[model samples]
Target: MKIAIAGGTGLVGRALTALLHEQGHEVITLTRGKPKNARHVQWLNGTLPLEQLEGIEAFVNLAGVSLNDGRWTAEQKEAIYHSRMTATEEMLRIVTQLSTPPQVIVNASAVGIYPISTTATYSETSTQRAQDFLGKTVADWEQKASRAKELGIRTCLARFGVILDTEAGALPLIALPYKLFVGGTIGSGKQWLSWIHVHDVARAILHAIETPSLEGAINFAAPQAERMKSFGKTVGRVLNRPHWLPVPSFALQLALGEKSVLVLGGQHVVPDKLMATGFTFQFPTLDEALHDLYKS
Candidate 1:
């Protein structure tokens, strides 16, 4: 298979691209900058080299601004929303121009589309949509990607949870206080955290690309969702540190502003679609995931 990926330099994008390469698929990465090599193609400018995208079988879009980069100022919020919309619109435009559009498109999404709740358990089938900033952004993002389905292309909206990895994503920051022996629960500690290992995220995306029956929204979360308190203890246990000295909710809100929702609020998301499709998680439990990441 020939695959073209946008935002291939991102954490999840890099992992998925490597997996595709290891499986003997030819990969092309679309970048905003100069083409780094033969496998890299510059896009997102007014013009794209359509010839380079020829024979591409699958298109995976992970393009967007990093929400964790800074506090959510008005300008930063606009950037977050427009960045995703513009990139996805570009993807649709490119596909329409292709003589042979890719059979499948795996567009990135987020579990944040679901409302933040400690009691509510959300799955792909859940219809209750969140109306907050993160939720609205994700809802609009998925709506844009859904355009591919109207073009008769199989589109999979991968609603990712908190992706855990030792080097990138949320794991390092979550584990940092533990490393320093000042780790403890964040906020109320009762907020649910639906997380998946980075390895599993890549696997789930690949599974979506290959599975014919899989379509619509598919969650990329572990089977079990842990509360922040338990999550902290697991991290401490894995790192051989103490889980003490809790960080108050007000402190995070003051520091992160609206961005604090990333940690202080969460949803208990379950991978119902993935599980029903026979997709197995490599790290199904928080303990298993943390141990694998922290092991020396």
Candidate 2:
């Protein structure tokens, strides 16, 4: 199969590309930055030229600014929003214009699409009612991906949780502080964190492509969802570090500004759609994921 990864240089994207390549699939990387190695097709503003949109069997749309890139100011928030929505819209438009569009679009979303407040339980069937900045960001991101349905292509929006990769994402950032024996949970740490291993995540995308029955929204998260405090303790235990001092919510709010929701706020998202479709997870437990990610 020939696949195009929009943000293929990113942490997860890089891993996905290599995995796909190893599996004997043709992988094309669409980037906004400098051309790296071969197999790169630069897409200005994430828009593929009309002539270049043919023959691709699948598209893994992971093009967006990093969510954990520090605090979210007004400008940074707008960039985050536009970066996702605009790129998705461009892909949808390009795919819509194609004579033979890709069979599937595995677009990335976030667990934040579900409201942080668990007044009502959320599943794939749950209606979207996002209030916060990141929530609204994901709301629009999924909205763009849903456009592929109009083109008669399968659109799979994999709303992810905190991706559990070792060097990138939250691991390295938190590892150092923990290694010093001062790492602990942020805020009251009662907020739920529905996370997934990067390997499971990549494999799930491949599943979406191979499985003809998949469409609509699917949560790309493990079955083992835990509170932030428990997550800290689990990671601390996995690394043999003492989970000591806590980072107060006020300090996090001050440091992260509106982006403090990443640490202070999260949702209890379950991979209902993915599971119902018979997707097996390799690292469904926090300990299993952490142990593998922390592998030396």
Candidate 3:
């Protein structure tokens, strides 16, 4: 299979790219700038050379900036929203123009689309929308990605949670405080933390591509969701450190501004749709995930 990936240079993209290559699939990356290598092609202002998308069997769109990278100023928020919307819209445009459109289009989304709650668990069927900036952004993101379905393509919206890995995503930063022996719960500690191992993230995307019936929003999260306090303790145990100190919400809000919700806010999400299709998680529990990530 030939797979074309947009934003194939980011954290999740890199992992997905490597996984596809291991499976003997030819991969081409669509970038915002000039082709960095033989594998990359440039996409300017949502326009691309149509020939590049021809005969592509699968399209995995993970194009977006890190929501946690910096404080979300007015300018930063616009960039975050535009980056996802434009990239996805561009992919749809290219696919419609292709002589042979891909069978599956797996788009990157977030569990943050659901409203934040301490006890409420959310599934794909949930009707209420998140009332914040990130939530609205994801809502629009999914809407744009869903447009591919109108072209008779099986589209899968992967609503990923906190992806845990030793090299990148949220794990390293969350583990750093534990490694230094100052780690503890963030905020009130009861907030839920829905997470998945990076290994499963790649597998889930492949599963969506192979399974024709799998479409719409699929939660790419573990079956077991943990509270912030418990999650902190588990990380501490894995790192052989003490979970004693607490990072105040005020401090985080002051430092991260509106972006503090990425940590202080919480969501209890599950991979019901993914599991319904018999997709098994590599790290179903926090203990299993943390141990695998921190093992020396």
Best by TM-score: 1
- What clash pairs does model 3 have? none
Candidate 3 weakest lDDT stretch, 10 residues: 44-53
Name the TM-score of candidate 2.
Answer: 0.94
Better of 2 and 3 by TM-score: 3
Which runs in model 3 stand beyond 4 Å of their true positions? 45-47
lDDT of the structure predicted as candidate 1: 0.94
The models' CA-based lDDT, in order, is 0.94, 0.83, 0.89
Best by lDDT: 1
What clash pairs does model 1 have? none
| Poorly placed runs, candidate 2 (over 4 Å) | 45-47, 50-53, 118-121
Which lDDT tens digits does candidate 3 get at residues 1-296? 99999888888888889999999998999888778887888885546667766788999999998886778999999999998987888888888888888999999999999999997999999887898999999999999899888899999999999998888777788888888888988899999999999888999999999998899999999999999999999888878899999999999899889988988998999899899999988888989988887773
What is the C-alpha lDDT profile of model 2 across 208-280, one tens digit per residue?
A: 9988898888888898788889988998998899998999999978877887878777788888877888899
lDDT of 2 at 115: 80
